[model samples]
Target chain A: MYSPACKVTDIASLIPQRSPIMMVDDYIIEDELNCRSELAVGADNMFLDETGRLSVEGVLEHIAQTAAAHIGYLHRQAGETVTLGYIGDIKRCAVTGPLPAVGTTLHTHVTVISQVGDVSLVSAETSAENNPILNCRMKVAEG
Target chain B: MEKDELVKKMIEILADEFEVEPEVIQPEANIKETMHLDSLSLVDMVGLVNEEFGVEIKTPDLPTIKTFADLYDYVFTRM
Candidate 1:
């Protein structure tokens, strides 16, 4: 039961974060070590800076949740329960461009660089319509 | 790549990242203590390996790797 694509509802079932806070919308399962997710920026986005744009932290959380979804997908494929995971550390984080405008669709990509015991190091990047926005490497772990 | 070549290349990569002299890195060297690699640098090291070797190193497996020789052996087997 490998679903190549997932909707928002499917994302809810896979991850612990709920709406208003959950940044990921749709995801494409590239493989066990990689995944791509979509986030539709809107005024309703929870973490918007004063300019009515997604805050930098929001973008980072989107990247983190994308990694979490990848882990959840792996567990699902293995017939195990999806557990809560936190972003333990973030390294080499860089925001290259301005925050995407409302109604824009951000494409996020994450790769699992390393996984030791409870901690997994992941590299992630977000772009809107081929324009790079931000990228970073994060350490994720189960709670 | 031969073992010696692999070791040389790894040293070069690490030296460039850690801003240390390549000659200072030896296969028997303990990267953390010798190179003063903090936890963040260790994460960056994993990134470097993934970029150069295209192999994803697991954190759980990092414990088994301490010295440059250990890293070389693990990476060599994967390569």
Candidate 2:
């Protein structure tokens, strides 16, 4: 059975997003085992590329942020406030988008591959209009 | 390692990072001029360089990287 939607509020509540650096309106998909969500490219955000479009790099960051939200949601669900974390490696990353363009929303998904101690290797994919925007293997370090 | 070898590696790294062909990378070219990479990419490249060569690459140091040769010489020397 599919689980109920978990509201992922502001990016600040999850990660350390300095003003203008943070992307995503809210992340709303996460669990101990997996994570998925969607975020829109608003008027703000520094990821605008030379084409003045929301960039593939920005999409990668947005998806990574969504992954962080999953961690935060799982923690909060268990009565934890927040935990420190960082993306270890963004390997095998691929992107296909005009990027930095408005009117685009990315559906970000992350699945846990393996967890050795406090580090988790996540398999991630983000799509827009059912077309892939980015996919990568990310390592997460917890402190 | 030879500076030429390092330059080749730097070019390779940029090509890998941008998913482009190494031939497209001008040895005497400005990365921003040919490639449209952002700051985060620069940071990631620095991390890649540091991890591969055990060197500390700061953003300020990026200014010295004009051509593939420059990148090769710098990494070969300091890193």
Ignoring the other chain, what TM-score does chain B have in each prediction? 0.91, 0.78
Give lDDT tens digits, candidate 2, residues B13-77: 77887787888887677776666655435555555676677775555677777766676677777
Clashing pairs for model 2 are A53-A99, A53-A100, A53-A101, A54-A99, A54-A100, A54-A101, A55-A99, A55-A100, B7-B72
What's the CA error at residue A43 for candidate 2, in Å?
Answer: 2.7
> Candidate 2: where is the Cα deviation over 4 Å?
A1-3, B1-79
- Candidate 2 chain A, which ten residues in sequence have the lowest lDDT sum? A112-121
lDDT of 1 at A119: 63
> Residue B14: error of model 1 in Å?
2.4
Q: For residues A58-126, could you state the per-residue lDDT of candidate 2 as single tens digits? A: 877776676776776667667888777777677888765544367777777787665444455577888
Give the best candidate by DockQ.
1
Per-residue lDDT over A21-112 for candidate 1, one digit per residue giving the tens place of the 0 to 100 score? 88988978876687899989978988888888888899998998889988888888889999998988887888999888789899998988
For all predicted structures, in order, the TM-scores are 0.83, 0.58
Model 1 vs. true fold: TM: 0.83
What DockQ does candidate 1 have relative to the true complex? 0.40
Return the lDDT, model 2, position A66. Answer: 69
